[model samples]
Target: MIDYNYVLRNHILTHNQIGNASDKSNTQRCDVCGTFLSSAYALKAHLQLHSDNSKPYTCTLCDRRYSSVHSLRMHEQLHTGEKPFKCEICGKDFSLRATYKTHMFLHSGERPHKCVLCGKRFKLSSSLKMHIRTHTGEKPHNCDTCGKGFSTLGNLRRHQRIHTGEKPYKCTECGREFNQSNSLKAHMHIHTGENLPKYDISVIIYSLS
Candidate 1:
């Protein structure tokens, strides 16, 4: 029989020795896969992939998150939510630049994605893939909080907030609640003196009663 207490003590001592060896060796590891991260910043970002606690880069339209600020800017259309990218044929609106590019094919009558099962065509490959998933009944995007299903990961992310009650956007002036930061920014104009646009007009009328 082995002395379990002695073995545990020895293991702890060895782990402490290794930890104190150098700062370069004490990198953060992935909790799930044990992948070593190079820097603390990278480790912090990698941790966000696991939990819904952090969202540094927020979308202006719907308060979505991305690893980079540029991605948030790209996601802003869901709010100005302006869908400037219009389909030439039916005038359908799309927030994504690529989706708009794909919609342009409607005017050209181009079918890029061909279905082998039913001889069908699609303008975008992603749409065709989603359509195929319907035949297979594939629902990969699921909400961890409420056990709801979504077709896209983005939709699932948006739904998860209902359970977490995580409203990251807040008005700086009045502390009002908003789903998106852009809305908070717009609300801030109420405090700033820029709420109304300037217009000048002069009118003179003479009437006899």
Candidate 2:
């Protein structure tokens, strides 16, 4: 029911009366500490697809409903694709400040968040939280249909695609579709010929001779 693709598209404005990201009051950055917030927020919004409870805030342009005004303001950025945060090391642009800060750790080689159980390190605390679930056997998210459990809300949503049959990832070259982004990436190598293995058969034939 939620036309996610429609809401995400770049909309052309007819007039300059509408506000842009330049206005801090209109579009402020999301909280950096809410690592799982986007996923949890999306899952809750997805629930609204089956319920009568409308989201508190809706996009002025797209009319896509969101739980909060902060979320609504954040969604407005998608219309213009304006990334305020930029990485100095890699010259990469990010929509969220938290993601930009986390990316800096990759260049700095600083794994501040470490798993207390297995001693594995992570750049993001949310990743460490999900990793800890592996040792504790804690799967907080569950499927309503099959009752299958997943540690993170993201994994649960991806699994729900099995029931929903939603294949969002598409191959531009072959027109093939996949349920997951990684699957689409793997499929792309077939067109780019990146995954093929090279063998020096001439050397083997000469050596045998």
Candidate 3:
């Protein structure tokens, strides 16, 4: 059902154009996939992905696959609970280097991705894409029970809980049930008497009389 060709037409055309423009005499062919590359360097780099020597390193825990040993070592951190990549600004630890780099943008106030319609900038491409949906009024995530639409999958999932009557969160003191976790925390504060100031009901009645 997915039209991958139409979706990746631009990417395919770029590679095909490069292959076509290269000299046929000097072109190198990939033995595995039969893809004609412009130079030996490109061909060699491509072959590294498919070579038998590639992906020699394997994860012992989950049996997840990786192309290189360095990749496998990085994957192992998920199981070992190691966070090597740390943000200098907030001191947040990330499991991967790419995640750490992305978090740094938040502190630097660098919004690279911009919206064409609203001229709003976002630090990440995903944030910009979500902002575009707001302008388009697009609600792709739908509730199965009520047929309600939401902008995000998380909002849709939360909406479904209303139909299911699933109250997962409960108060420890009074055993009061709440649909949301934040509501439960607020309810707990009522018992703790932390937020609200105590008021005399008799004082208002006496004043009125």
Best by TM-score: 3
Error of 1 at 119 (Å): 6.8
lDDT of each: 0.61, 0.66, 0.70
Off by over 4 Å in 2: 1-103, 196-209
Candidate 2 vs candidate 3: which has greater TM-score?
3
TM-scores for the candidates: 0.33, 0.47, 0.49
Name the best candidate (by lDDT).
3
Model 3: ten consecutive residues of lowest lDDT: 12-21
Off by over 4 Å in 3: 1-76, 80-82, 171-173, 181-209
Q: Please list all clashing residue pairs in model 2, or write none if there are none.
A: none
Task: Please estimate how well model 2 matches the true structure, expressed as its whole-model Cα lDDT.
Answer: 0.66
Clashes by residue pair, model 1? none
Q: In candidate 2, residue 127 scores what lDDT? A: 88
Q: How does model 1 score by TM-score? A: 0.33
Q: In candidate 2, what are the lDDT values of residues 65-163, reduced to their tens digit?
A: 887777776778878798999998789998867778899998999999876545799999988878867765657677998989788999999999999
Candidates by lDDT, descending order: 3, 2, 1
RMSD per candidate (Å) reads 21.9, 18.4, 14.8
Model 3 TM-score relative to the real fold: 0.49
